[model samples]
Target: MRYSKEHKNQTHARIVKRASVKLRERGAHGIGVADLMKEAGLTHGGFYAHFDSRDALVIEAVTHAMDRSTERWRKLSEETPPEKRLSKIVNSYLAPEHRDNPGQGCAVPALAAEIARESSKTRRVFSGRMEQMIDMLADQYPGLPRKAARKQAMAALATMMGSLVMARVTGNSELSDEILKSGRDAVLERAASSEKKPPRRAATSV
Candidate 1:
């Protein structure tokens, strides 16, 4: 029996979802169509009906992972108090669990370097998703000007991504935690300093 259009869409979405996580865990090049399809609980033959080509599926998978991560952040942020949002985001993201399981974690840190060498279309999708994530993070600082908020987001994202990469590459767990803490403290301290600026005295005549 033929399934409805909605059923087809759901199946396709499932394929993308599974592929996205696999791509994150094992870089895009590491996974093949058959493996991804099998993981998605679909047959290899049905794959082509869902996507025009492997590239098309890759693009969709990237977007799917991005959306999942963003939704997770939103939920986490909402459940957490404002003051602890930064800590929550940083600590959880940099933890060993997230590092080891990129399949279920943020896409930027997981796949940014890999996606950079992909086609322009892939890069564009990655860029757009990153911008949205940064914007969400910037919104946490309502008091700061747009430029300042963007800068702060840049620091936080860069620190987290860089520290994670270093930690993973060195295969040193203690060093990884240290790197995470140092980066987190640096960004938080800078933000705190900005909040409590030193008072300016009246200029005295020389």
Candidate 2:
């Protein structure tokens, strides 16, 4: 049966959306084209109609997931006070709900390990998205120089990702909660401390 352009576009989007969540739930290699197509309520032969290759689908899926995550973070930043933005993001990222539901949370914590083993093109795309995430966090940082703020964002993101990874790996829920709390406190403390410091004076040649 011949499908209209709109129908094809919608179906393509649906496949990518499902692929995004499933990619998070299953590692990069955990899912195959047939299963993804079945989950999308489409035929496996139709996969190539939407994407040139599985790698293409992977890139698109990761991009979709990261974009969804950033959009949520943008909303949080909008609704939150400038001083509280970082904390809100960190709390959301490290929450038990996010930890337990890998398919719905940020892609970084869910797919970072698997992405490292993907193709160079995939890694480059992920790297670019990671920068976007870092820059989003940096935007909320007031008073600090842009460079310093970006560096701070990088560190905070690393901590959040690592803490969540450890939390998920361990059998202890109590320890996991503690890890989240500690990660939050540490990031917030650093942010608060940075806010208190005076920006360095520019050097003047004598």
Candidate 3:
């Protein structure tokens, strides 16, 4: 029996959403197309109906995961006072809850390595989404010029992503926690220092 347009759309969404979480939890190549379709409660035969290929599904899944993370950061930044927005984002991202939940957390640390090895089209899509994230982060620093703020955002995001990767891989729980805390503290400190005004030079005699 043929499904209606709405039903088809819904099913497609379900597959993408499930694929997003599974991809993060198990890396890009860890799960096969049949397995993903099975988990989504659909048959492998229907996979082609929604996407042209497994690569297409992967691109869609990566986009979905990154978009969700960006939206989360946007909401956190919106709800916070401008002065505290950066700290709020940094804390929430580096928290233990985010660290322990790979399936629902940021996609960078989870999928960056895999994406680097993907096709050029896939890498381009990932790069575009990453740019959106960096731009959103730069918005939190209204005190700095656009270029300066973007530079700072790049540095801050790199630290957070790198720290998260290390935290997840380290066998020791205490070290993991310490890594999170250090990353959070360092980002906040760097942000604070960047916004400070430089001291005035003493007037020289003529």
Question: What does candidate 3's lDDT look like per residue over 1-206, in tens digits?
Answer: 99999999999999999999999999999768988889888899989999999899999999999999999999998899988999999999998888889999998999999999999999999999999999999998898889988999999999999999999998349999999999999999998898896644799999
* TM-score-sorted candidate list, best first: 2, 3, 1
Could you tell me the TM-score of candidate 2? 0.95
* Steric collisions counted per model: 0, 0, 0
In candidate 1, which residue ranges exceed 4 Å CA deviation? 198-206
Top model number, lDDT: 3
Per-residue lDDT tens digits of candidate 1, residues 1-206? 79999999999988888888888888878669997888778788988989989889889999988888777778889999998787787777777877667678777777888898889999999899888888877876656779888888888788878877776775657877677677777777877776577545789998
Is 1 or 2 the stronger prediction by TM-score? 2
RMSD versus native structure for model 3: 2.6
Q: Residue-wise lDDT of candidate 2 within 46-126, one digit each (tens)?
A: 899999999999999999999998999999989999778888998898888888888988888888988999999999999
Off by over 4 Å in 2: 202-206
Per-residue error at 44 for model 3, in Å? 0.9
Predict model 2's lDDT versus the native: 0.89
Residue pairs in collision within model 2:
none
| Model 3: residues with Cα > 4 Å off, grouped in runs | 199-206
For model 1, what is the C-alpha lDDT against the true structure? 0.81
Each prediction's TM-score against the native? 0.89, 0.95, 0.95
